[model samples]
Target: MSGSSRVLIAEDDVRLAGMLEGLLRSEGFDVEVARDGQRALHLGLTAGFDAIVLDRGLPAVEGLDVLRRLRDSGITTPILVLSALGTAPDRVDGLNAGAEDYVAKPFDIDELVARVRALTRRASAVVPTVRFPGGRLDPESRTVTLDDDTTTALSERESALLELLARRPGQVFSRALLLEEVFAAADDPGVVDTYVHHLRRKFGRSLIETVRGVGYRMGSLS
Candidate 1:
């Protein structure tokens, strides 16, 4: 039971998709559904999720294409392919296309839930801790530890923003880009400034740098 873990279900069968959503929700997982491959790809790239359940017969982009694109873009989220193409070759193709697990159609709902839980557990176990000048950030736990060893938990947005900057220190990121990628096209760009201010107050004023007439970048952790 991956309590509160987020999952994306890219399934086209309306009845099946809705059933899966209700199942995952009852298991205490946060779930989002995309009825087609195009929307699936968009959410897979822009949003963060613990696991993904993708259907091979998706319309618009096809499931394997979507899986390849996500992998090519460096998205490491665990994906389980669910489809009626249950042949040996089909299973091989799904696995070869970067799916962590493959579940054929007519799957037992309980079994599907178990596999998803396993994927989330494995992903959480392997997330690498990011180290910076004066601190370290844990991606799985969303916690930061300063040189003084004071640990603080960050909200999802805060952790995402800080991780983006810290991962590419000194690289500038514009507010528009941040809104699109981090906040998933938030209506107000000012939200970026608000989170930056929150991070500065929690960590320090110098934790991030503002680029005049441009955007923001990682600053000296001091």
Candidate 2:
């Protein structure tokens, strides 16, 4: 809380990861993302994050296994599990694996941000910066300044979406996947298109490309 808190996101779903990364960046938290649990685990050990947003279902290594391994190694960094599994049993599984918190899929961005802040605030040190293409975002400030010095205040949703895209530039994402990451479980699937429209209007049509029958892609030109 005193400085920028770093958050590592471990999720396989491309669109969902982008959404979360974008939202958290706007909240002033430094964020790093991994496409699967194996890469996530490797970073979890080698990368110094204030906390982590881990997905229970992951590729390469199961999220639970990654958490368990981290705990076994005595890494006490707080972990918040983000999963589509909403049942009590599933939540319990994540918690038992040493996660600091469990967030069900179809989560509210505000709620997710609150949890990340709470967890990171407990850390005594600031999370380090992880840079990528597009621009460097200060996770602690929640402000984004483009390469050309253009800047904007991202709504929680916009930030999350952008973060995910920044994680892997030029990757296409589907509307349904975006919906799952940014909106709460109660949001209707149709709302994803609306959000995308808003994002295109703000970020420019060229920044995020429509994939026709599939979904959307960022950094289409680069």
Candidate 3:
């Protein structure tokens, strides 16, 4: 779930855009490049990017304008704005316009990667109040509380998958469905299996019953 997902980068600077794309790819991210704000808005609206690396100064439409439009359209993908206009007002403006974070130009690649990672951690996350027979899964904080008041913390992906299963305690969910709803990695269905394995290890195998030829579900603990 970390660094193995898609990211869209919107930068008008050809060299900077290429650099950002290459950097993200080197870190194992699926990269999409948009050279201007209009294209950025189009891609941001239609495509499902885990996170966006946006530049404040873009052709056609400014990055902040794109963010405003996306927000208006109810697109909540985390945006990290990268710009050369490094000023208190500029950073404030970018953040105020709906960017989750701002990075001034000529920034350290590692720092940029760190910011991107943090933003993705939040975007791909699910926070739902999901209930099963004897337990409740809280996605916001990634915690599972049992009927006995015992609580166990889960990772982001684990919590998301658990929340999906908890929604229908006895109903089975196939790997494909889980991939679509929980894993957020539609390219690989096998990722669901890994998270399911993690869930089994965390909450005990009996809690999640896997149908031999089918899929898995949250079973009654009572």
* Candidate closest to the true structure, highest TM-score: 1
lDDT of 1 by residue, 1-222 (tens): 444798999999999999999999998899999999999998887676889999999999999999998876556789999999999999999999999999998999899999999998877778756556678888789999987999999999999898887755646889998888789858999999999999999988788899998899777665
> Which candidate's lDDT is highest?
1
Judge candidate 3 at residue 33 and give its lDDT.
99
Q: How well does candidate 3 score on lDDT at residue 10? A: 95
Cα lDDT of model 2 by residue, 81-139, tens digit = 99999899999989999998999989998888998989888765543232333444454
Candidate numbers sorted by TM-score from highest down: 1, 3, 2
Instruction: Report the CA-based lDDT of candidate 1 relative to the real structure.
Output: 0.87
- Give the TM-scores of the predictions, in the order they appear: 0.63, 0.55, 0.58
Q: Lowest summed lDDT over 10 consecutive residues: which window, candidate 2? A: 127-136
The candidate with the higher lDDT, 2 or 3, is: 3
Error of 1 at 117 (Å): 0.7
Comparing 1 and 2 on lDDT, the stronger one: 1
Question: Which ranges in model 3 have alpha carbons more than 4 Å from their true place?
Answer: 1-3, 127-222
Over the stretch 55-134, how does candidate 3's per-residue lDDT look in tens digits?
Answer: 98899998899999877554667899899998999999998998889999889999999889888888667443566667
Judged by lDDT against the true structure, how good is candidate 2? 0.75
